[model samples]
Target: MDISTDVWGQLALEASQVYLTEGGQVRSPFASTTIEKLPDKVLLNIFSYLTHREICRMATVCRRWRMVAYDTKLWTHVSLRPEISGLHVSSLESLLALISIRFGPSLRYIELPIELITHTVLHELAAKCPNLTHMLLDFSTAMQLHDFSEMQAFPTKLRYLCICLSEVIFMEGFMRKIYNFINGLEILHLIGTYEKVEEEEEEIYEVINVHKLKSATPNLRVINLYGINFVDDSHIDAFSSNCIQLECLAVNFCNKVTGSTMKTLFQRSRRLTCLLMNGCSLRSDYVMQVEWEKSSVQELDLTATDLSTECLIDMLTRIPNLRFLSAGQINGFNDSVLKAWVEAGTARNLVALDVDSSDNLSDEALHRFLSRHGSQLHGLVLGGMPHITDQLWQSVLQLLNNANDGRYYEIVKANFERADRTTVVRTSTNCRVSNYYLLSNYNDLIFN
Candidate 1:
């Protein structure tokens, strides 16, 4: 895909005094009229590209500018985060108050830190922004409040949620209420509650029923959970029964989820296209014995998980439509796997790969893998293989060079070419790390 013009438009507006450059006409190098003389539509277009902080700063310029800056389209998608460490609560309250008045009713997507999940603020949000769809909470801060009965009070149309709460909080009627109320929720991202509770509370902490959560979100297509430990056999069964439309299931560091649950998910969710499991102790037998479904999984990520060689090959063998594969350090994920992949002709169809930090993989194996698969690859990550030399990196570069030939890939190719020139040799790794991948802008495509 082309580097979106929207992204370029934002960057240009931020750094340059831009104009409509759609024609061959070239105007004077300087402007005769001030920004105040610009039309409202033009000003709105510029304001739409700015972030909340920049808009706030721009609003302080002049009354005419401030009036123009308040366009509803410009404030629809609001993203806020802490600017500095140890911020005072009063500053946050003041900011929220300002946002309520300034952005009122037009908001669609809001991403904020966990510190801002206040009841009053959420209630205000629910009242004002009824059309909100996505809300992401950065889980760096410990959430102090519970009672997200307030979430029902946040936004009725809120379908995408990313929150990291303690398991105790999940048990205490937050998720159940959310699932019950927000039936339209398609994406529920739980950023694993890995933070330890007080020593006293850990002893008494009890597990809650996750089946209720599954029952509540029947329409869910994506459930990405991190550091979660509550998912079990019952939860899996509930999901299998209820969430048939689910396409993406990502569980990272969730030790409680067994391989049997995974197999059930694979068998049941017919539309399931992506399976991402990281740091889970999934048994090889249950994982390898997955039965077929209508929607063949196209993306598989086993990074940082305990996957053996036999299980890995079996999964690849069974899942025929896989175009993306991300794996971490697995023993015997060297020439043997590469040979099997190439021989099976599975290597030719792959679109992306992220096999970082393999201790045993040689340059010859990667060469064969890439020669077979490189034509189709849009993204690749081979960082930390000890055997790959400088000459081998060049060979790998030559192998995927054809990926640069197309209108959609021009900007990507340019960026890659620029990186090749601007690269400073790093002695630590013995090669510029950027050599491992093209289209750095497409990192998200590698796993999703």
Candidate 2:
């Protein structure tokens, strides 16, 4: 090794030795040795795998290790869980200070659970982490927050933001801030927000004016909004007009979205790719899928919607590139329509298919759907299809193997991921669902 390498080794050994020799102390495994004696980069590698809490603890162990742990890459991803206690306002400020001082520019992600995070902390974090790209904040209060105006000049480089607020007042300010500040954001997810209703004795139709929200964001690609209530059609209309560049849009459990209004958005936004409309009351007389001049939408998710399967299929076939599809819990989409979807137009590109929670599809229907298209299909989600047995799942896997080249078959339940060049499968006992997870050279399957 070079002199620089040897020097670092010596420093680590001496540091380790000091810790062991301190006090009438109980001797550790390396009581007489020092960190300097160990491989210089070995500890660095160990730091990479540790959680933020573990890394913070290790930073205080010794001066030599502190320097190594202070590497900017160590603080690239930050997770603030509600369950992990001992974080007060002051502590949060101090932690932010430390993080900013040590690795400001490299910071990317921040996760705080819904119940624990306060508005004060949110403001502080927004102020400090200017280069923040991804954030998940769950605020349980109904208070209207100040403009995240502090982040205006910092960097609107945010790509993904997931916010779960309990009250509409909180969203009013938050949305205003986002409209005023982060104009170039790509993917935005808003969930679980209550509406701001009138408490007075005389209250009529409420009009929420979101004209301030008309600014355009050309780069925004995916938008997922769920479990929120909007007062009227205009509010919903204003929100949709902002994200003209949307590709994948998911709005679940939203009470204010009308089917006609939704159809209007589909007509206007030409670049939409994947559309997920779940748990919404789209009880229109008839949902007519509007034709777009430059329709590029491929995947369509109509889980728990009121649209009939025939109506959905009629609307879907309009998009030429239609591929992966999910229609769970749509009582209207019967066996014939699904099988037809699996076999006909652009279905060859249909790699993943989910039909969970549908009382309409039976075992025979599912078997026919899978068996016919099993060769082309890579992922099949049959959750809440209580009629499907383990026997059927096994047959589907076997057929996929027979159809494709001799690639190893992999089964994933609950969640699955791809890392480096390998496939990782993790099963959860939360529910028994039939999934046609396979080992492919492509993307992973994630369900939440």
Tens-digit lDDT track of model 2 for 143-167: 5444445433333667666665554
Candidate 1 Cα misplacement greater than 4 A, ranges: 1-31, 83-100, 112-119, 137-154, 167-171, 195-209, 229-234, 292-295, 402-448
Mind sharing the TM-score for model 2?
0.71
lDDT of each: 0.64, 0.59
Compute the lDDT of residue 407 as modeled in candidate 2.
47
In TM-score terms, candidate 1 sits at: 0.76
Best by TM-score: 1
Report, for all candidates in order, the number of backbone clashes.
1, 11
- TM per candidate comes to 0.76, 0.71
The count of residue-pair clashes in candidate 2 stands at 11
